[model samples]
Target: MNDHDYYRAFLHAVWHDRSADPLVASLLAQPAFAVYRNTIFKGCVDALAANYPAVQRLVGAQWFQGAALAYARRNMPQDASLIAYGDGFAAFLSGLEEASELPYLAGVAALDRCWTEAHLAADDAALDAAALHAALAAGQDVRLVPHAAARWRWEPAHPAYSIWSANREAVETPDELAWRAEGALLTRPVGEVRWQGIGPGACRFLDACGDGAGVAASAALALEAEPGLDVAAMLGALLQAGAFTSFH
Candidate 1:
């Protein structure tokens, strides 16, 4: 094979199946290649641990690393940047037989993924409360959108948000949890990632807004989820959370 083709096969073997590539088949028995392969595995595990700190903390280092290694076997980083290594980790975890008992683990992994996405998003000016109010006062249907760094998730199956929000900073689990469906809102409004446990009303409202619905329509959706929801107060809270970008 040509040098380029040989190199590609070698790398493919390192990342995937050694026996599957002609070049890799030749190097598998070499001591140097073996060491290099182990190093790559360790690097993938390390990258996964960094990318999913919340998951690592919840599952502990040994268990987390074991799972990370397994995940890396099937899903290696497509990009050179290790920071973006674990994109499908949550979904991967969800399918793992080992993680079946821990129903919330995959959700927590998803929350961690959201935090990473928010942290890495391009900076954008969030719509101030005054600006939003002014556009509404003018009786105009302006296009409003979630901020570039805004990410939210709502899951009715498990209290994933509560557990993740609590364990995000440190490994301090709450003394007691209500154990119900929960939602989380993440934003990097001021160059620092922030998160909070949100409610069904806010979740539905954000969902509607993200679908390009207007203010009234979004409010109706929120009210449907929560009959006595204080729509104005929810807006103010979301405004404070930097959930919106500049209105057009």
Candidate 2:
């Protein structure tokens, strides 16, 4: 094999701990390579931990680190660049049968992942109240374009928002089990990620808006999802949160 091919083989052997295999050891000594391999593995573990703090809190740091280690071993990041290292972690958590008992765990991981993505996403100008008011006054069809990084959806049985928020604070952790499934939105309006729980109606409205539905149609969808929901109030709340970038 060429020198380039040999180097690639050496790296794989070291990273995968195949150095003990006859084919690998023939090229490099095992003891020297093992040290470098351990460092690389630990670095990946640390990166995952830093990326998923809320998950770490939910599962406890020790258990989270352990899981991160295992996850890294199984799914060594394809990219050498660390900026997007944990991109596939939500899927990893979802497929882990051991974590299935905490169904919300995957959701929590997803929310955390979304937060990271939102933070790094391209910046956008926020819509102002005056502009929105004028659109409303003119009776122009208003449609909100949420930030590209925003994630809005409803969960089936987990208070994913509550767990994420409560864990971020230094206060006592709240009882996640008591929380019923709720709709939530995560956004980054000014370089900071924020999470908030909204009603089913609001979620539906946001989903509609996200899909290019007009304001009126979005409101109607919200009301359809929850007959008792106050469409006017929810719209006001979303506007105040700077959830929309523009009205079209």
Candidate 3:
């Protein structure tokens, strides 16, 4: 076999089949090799811990570490950079026996993943209010363009947003109202990640905009989601949150 192919197989054995590989078994017999393996395992655990702090806090450090190790063994990182690791962690948690008791845990992990995504998204300029206003005035139908970093998705199954907010701020007492289905919006404005729970109307409006719908059409969608939705207020709030890059 070629050098690259040989090393690739060796790495796969080290990562996934150490016990079965004679070379790995020989290495396992050495204390130094064991230390190296332990260090690699710990690195994976630490990266998971950092990526999912809310999960770590909820499950306690020991339980979280055990779960992290198991997850790492099952789903090794495909990316060279650890920063983008743990994309499937939420799904992994959802399939776990322990997570069955905590139904919202998986959703919370998913929400946390959104934060990472928002933070890592490409930076882009936002449309000035005056420019947007001028475009709206000139055009019969204006379509709002969303920022590259902006994302809005409603989680209806569990209070994922509330749980995420509580853990993010380390709240001593969480709001009871937060224990319901809510819309989550994540964005990066001025190079800092910001996220909040938005109203259903705003969620629909944002979704419509993302679908490349015009303002009038997006407003109709928002109204369908919430008949009493304040069209002006919803638009203003989204604008203030830096959700839109331009309107044309």
Global lDDT of each model?
0.88, 0.78, 0.82
lDDT of 2: 0.78
Candidate 2, residues 127-167: lDDT per residue as tens digits? 77788888888998788888676777687788877776666
Highest lDDT against the true fold, candidate: 1
Best by TM-score: 1
lDDT of 3 by residue, 53-170 (tens): 8888788899999989999887767877788689899999999997798888988788778888888899889869887777777766888899999988787777788887778667
TM-score, structure 3 vs. true? 0.89
TM-score order, best first, reads 1, 3, 2
Candidate 3 residues lying further than 4 Å off, grouped into runs, are 19-31, 173-178
Clashes of each: 0, 0, 0
Better of 1 and 2 by TM-score: 1
- Per-residue CA lDDT of candidate 1, range 75-179, in tens? 767888788788999999999998899899999999999999999999998787787898888987666699999999998899998788777888577778778
Q: What TM-score does candidate 1 reach? A: 0.94
